[model samples]
Each structure stands twice: as C-alpha cells, then as structure tokens.
Target chain A: MAAFIIANGAAAMGDDVTMFFTFWGLNALRKPENIKVKKSFLQGMFGKMMPRGADKLGISKMNFGGMGAAMMKTVMKQQNVTTLPELIQTAKEQDIKMIACTMSMDVMGIREEELIDGLEFAGVATYLGEADEANVNLFI
Target chain B: MAAFIIANGAAAMGDDVTMFFTFWGLNALRKPENIKVKKSFLQGMFGKMMPRGADKLGISKMNFGGMGAAMMKTVMKQQNVTTLPELIQTAKEQDIKMIACTMSMDVMGIREEELIDGLEFAGVATYLGEADEANVNLFI
Candidate 1:
C-alpha cells in the first residue's frame, strides 16, 4: 500500500516512477484466483494462510485476524482515500512502470499469465540499472 | 536496513531527509542496554524476542533465529557495504532529521532517554506537516 501510494504520488508530481515487485511483493499484483503457490509444504501453507490480493492484505502490525485491515479499509473509504486496488489502478492509469522480478517469480512458482496485464518482467540487474539512474530509489 | 541505506544515499545526493520512527521502527533507535519494556506481558515478551539495537536487527525474511542477519552482516562487511549501525551513524552525520512518534513511544514504553541523541519528538500531525511540503515523502 505504501509503495502504491508513493508511486501514485510521485507519478502525479510528473516524476517518472517504476515499481519493482519482488518475492512476496508480487502477490499484490496477482489475480485473486491465481494467488496460489506451493514451493514447499511450509511455503504452501504460508501461501494459503496469507491474503490473496491487494485488497485482502492486512496491516503488518496490529492486524487482529484481519479486523484491522477491514477497519482501515472502512476508514479509507469514509475519508475518500483510495484503497490499495484503487491506488494500483491509478498507478497503471498514470503510466507508472511496473516490473515483476523474473527470478522471484521462478522461485515462487508464479507465472506471467497469473499477474495483471501491462507489466514488464525483469531481473535484479534490470532493477539495478533503473535504480542506478533514478534520483529516488526505494525498496518497499 | 533498506530505510537507512536509502536515507544515507539520499543524504549523500544532498536531498533533505526526515525519517519518522514509529511503532516497531523505534527499536532501531533504542540503546542496546535500554531496550527492555514491561508495558504488558505480551509487550514485554515482544521486547525480549526482538533485536535490541540496529546492529542486532534480523532480516525480515528467512531470518532463521538471527542466523540470516549474522550472515548478511558478514557478507556486508566483506562487500564493504555499510552496516545498519554505521548507516545510522552516517544518517546522524549527514544531519537527516530523525523524528520519533511520541504516541508510539508511549505505547511501546520507550523513553526519550533510551533513544540515541539528536532526535526530535512529534506525532502524526507533525509528520504530515513536513510531508505536505516535501517533494518526496516515504513511509518506510
């Protein structure tokens, strides 16, 4: 959510932005029904237990059985603030470059088709190239 | 470590930076000997389990009983990369403003004296006030 918000804000300010999604971060871009992975028995359990999509993601702290996430969503709606999905949509609309880590995808058993449309697939070297030229590089 | 590295990098590039230390983040600023907290049984247990200082912090992923953290630290040293403590010290030297959330401090039972010197105390409103005027705002 923080990454999406910051990317949206930066893009809104006319700055070029690229979001490099790696490892668990790629889960945000996964299609709800396509969010399953089974690298190992433990990892499969983690995948099943964790939230599926961006909207379903819970807060890192004080997430009481997803109640905190629900409450936060409600508050965001009330405050007219964009939710994670909406922010992601805005990011796409704003033409912010989205790249999924190919190596991470391979390790996590995530296929390109399972992710949302209009994303580039790249590796860490690609990310390093971008970050090398970026004035503000963030790893969220 | 990502936060500190980015902050240090930004500061090196001459960008004005302010790090808002809130919730679990305040742990990085804690003096190793003064990291104890007894607010509640649960909170105290958390304090006991968590790393005491910046140098002791474990990796977010694959942190096998702090083995990952120690290994990473060793690799960082070999690569001549700045360690977390060194990064924090660099942040101080670079004059990056470090703000501790007063409300978080109260909740976590962290006192001002327990934190490193040269820090400001503020709440969310204060963070917002600075973020409002800044061209780039990150919540890490």
Candidate 2:
C-alpha cells in the first residue's frame, strides 16, 4: 500500500521518483542500512525491539495525533478511505521500484557490505538525477 | 517552504500547482471556518467547544503517520528531509498562494459561508482548471 501511494503519486506527476529509504524504510530493499533503534529508556531496559524494515515502516494514509489518529481513521472508515497498510501492499504488488539511501547506512553504522540482498546503493547523484526528472517529490 | 517546494516542483514539471489544505494544515490560514477543537474523549467530555474546521485537521509534516510512520520519520530525519510544517510555514512566509479544500471543510460541518478571510473556494473544478493546464498536478 505504501508503494501504491508513492508510485501512484509519482506517476500522477509523471515523474521518475526514486525513493532513497535510509534507516528503516530501506528494509524493503534489503539495503545494508538498518534504522537506529530510538529506544525509550524503559523499552531499552526491557530489551523490547520496535518493528523493523521498510515493510514495517511504511505507514498508512491516515495521520496519527490529537485523538491519536482515531479521528482520521474514523472519518476514513466512515468515508471509505483506503487503509495505509493496504496501500503499501498494493504498491508492492503493483511492482513499484524503490531505492535505498547509502549515506544513511554509513552514518548509522549500517554496512553496505552487510546489507540484505536484493538491494542496490546510489548516492545523492542518483537521487538528484531522478529528482531532476521528477515533477513531484516527497521525503515520506 | 511549501511554496518553495511546490513552486520548484511545479516549475520542474512546467506546471502551475495549487496547494489546497483542509483539516489541520489549514491552521495557518486564519479562516473563520477553520477553528476546531481536536478533542479526544477527555477533551470532548470536558473542554470548551471548538470548530471542526480545516485549520485544526491539517497535519504538520514533522509528526505525521499512517501505518509504519515510526521508521519513516527516523529515516527522513536522518536523511535531512524537511518536515511538512516547515514547508507550509515557508510557503506562507514566502507569499505562496494556498487554497483550502472546501469539500473537506464542508464535510466537517464547516461554514464555507464563514471561512476565514482571504481564502477562495470553488469545487474540484477550480483545482481541475489549474490542473488541466498543469503538466503536473500534485496532491501534497
């Protein structure tokens, strides 16, 4: 579903969008970088790990806050808006190509040498090159 | 910042983009129709009443989420990406013309007849007219 929104949005602008997922979103591509665990002291003490990977990081369409996102979801459910997870899954199923950022890996002690397979690395040039062709671009 | 991004992005595609915010993002607009309380059970049950308009509903880029928001934020911050709030504020400060989404406003029981001053309202046709001429039309 995340892919679907991204791919569709990028496609809507008719531009080539290259998502450079550093940290966790890179999980989808198995890029060498893993997101730093911003552990709460409590969670850290308990050794409770957060969800990992791009697969887990790509959020849904509804925003979270205030009523803690329930309002958006309630309205969406009432209005029949698609769920974020569904959109991410749909994007993947639709074959949206994603790229992982390499710089973040090096910054976070993630080893491109040890990154998961099925992923490739490209630097700012790669992102800029693609952005040059993109009519629209978004970080999230 | 939003205007800079939008102008640059739209111009990148040689398109004129109209950024219309409804719900929470509209808070910057100062329209009468956009004064709502984003109350929860406690707030709703105990706080004073507020408008359920666009300003309160629009979200800031720094802390937005749908599904896998946590990882996305970490990656974005690490990547040095700017948040949407900054983008919107930049747009406002830079004099970028922003339109509020009237459909969303009305659905939220907003009084379009009483929207904050300086805002223009038309249907999707308004956006469509601009979008039609635009080589790239964007939702963000």
Task: Residues A1-140, candidate 2: write the lDDT tens digits.
Answer: 33344464454444443456656554444322443455456534332233343333323333233342455445445545555555545445444555657786555444454444445577778888887775545454
Give the DockQ (2 decimals) of all models: 0.07, 0.09
* Model 1 vs. true fold: TM: 0.56
True contacts kept of each: 0.03, 0.00
Best by lDDT: 1
Task: Give chain B TM-scores in order.
Answer: 0.90, 0.49
Question: Mind giving the per-residue lDDT tens digits that candidate 1 earns over A1-140?
Answer: 99898899999999999998976788888778854443554334345544567876778777897799889889999999999889989999999999998755654456787788899998655665577677787767
For model 1 the local lDDT of residue A58 reads 74
lDDT (Cα) of model 2:
0.48
Interface RMSD list for the candidates: 7.7, 7.0
Off by over 4 Å in 2: A1-7, A10-16, A23-67, A106-121, B1-17, B33-97, B102-114, B117-140
Which lDDT tens digits does candidate 1 get at residues B1-140?
65776677677777788999998899899888854434677666666676677877777764668655665565445446667889899999999999999999887767787788899999999999987776566665
Q: How many backbone clashes does every candidate have?
A: 0, 30
What's the TM for model 2?
0.47
